[model samples]
Target: MEVYLIRHTQVAVDKSICYGQSDVPLAETFARDALALEQKLKQQINDLHSAKILSSPALRCKQLAEYLGQEIEYHPDLLELNFGQWEMQAWKDLPPEEVNPWMEDFVHLRPPGGENFVELQARTARVFDALPQLEQSPVVIIAHAGVIRSMICKAIGLPLSNAFQIEIDYGSVSKLVCRWGLWNVKFLNL
Candidate 1:
């Protein structure tokens, strides 16, 4: 099985804002970025026309998936980590006291009214577990950074605590291959 993970294009929100699962708009450069990604993806993946395309239900991801002109299967499980009360708030503006605990142990610490990194990994894992059963190879999943990171972690047998070490930039693509029940990362942040 060949899996391609694509992060959504840049969001319209400011850099300091935390908009996880907040349904934000795509940036003005979406069309240009999408076109470039499409071209690059075509060059990288053979049989692109027959590959199965999946995406998060979030508008940011949906926009890019649609722009790619593929029939997209939207999955809510592919959404970014739920930031809860931090959604749409600037990270710098968040209460340091409230943020400290999560920062100290993000993998296990649930933010105030939010899910922990472990929860995010579980949902992403579920989505990945179903991929091999799908009737397609070179499966493309368009989703958020967190979702892609979690998938990479799961693929490489890396602990969720080290997820931040994998950089999933907006509009970037990562590839993975599964064979005989073992996973191998092809490349990342392409």
Candidate 2:
């Protein structure tokens, strides 16, 4: 299976805000960014519209996926880590006591009402593990940086704690190939 994981375009929210799993608007550059991404996919795949399109229900991701093809499958497992009560709060404004613990070990510690990285990884794995059943030549997943990183970690056997090191930029595309139940990362943040 050829999996292309594409992060959504820039969001309208401020950089300081914590917006995991929150519905956010796309930035002003959405159209331009989406167009460029479409062209990029077209180069790799013969029919952009025919490739199986899966995306998180988030508006940011949905917009990009719709731009690529009208037939899209939305899955909750593709969503970013749920930030719980910190949905729209500024990162600086979060209570230090609560943030400190999670900052130290976010893989296991939950942010008040949010889930940990392990949960995110498990959900993401479910979607990826099922890819073989679809028997599709190419699969396009439009999701967040966190989701992409989780998939990368699983693909490369990297630890969840090191996920941040992958650097998944907005509107970036990462490719992975799966064969005989083994996964290999082809490229990242393209």
TM-score of each: 0.97, 0.97
The C-alpha RMSD of each candidate to the native structure, in angstroms, is 1.0, 0.9
* lDDT per residue (tens digit) for residues 68-172 in model 2: 887899999999999999999999999999999998999999988889999999999999888889966799999999999999998889999999999999988
Native RMSD of candidate 1 (Å):
1.0
The C-alpha stretches of model 2 lying farther than 4 A from their native spots are none
What digit string (tens of lDDT, one per residue) describes model 1 on residues 1-190?
A: 9998999988889999987889998899988999989987998886677888999999998988888756888999999999889988999999999898888888998767889999998998888999889988889999998899899888888998899988999899999999998999989999
What do the candidate models score in CA lDDT, each in turn?
A: 0.89, 0.92
Question: Candidate 2 has what TM-score?
Answer: 0.97
Those runs of model 1 whose alpha carbons end farther than 4 Å from true positions after fitting are none
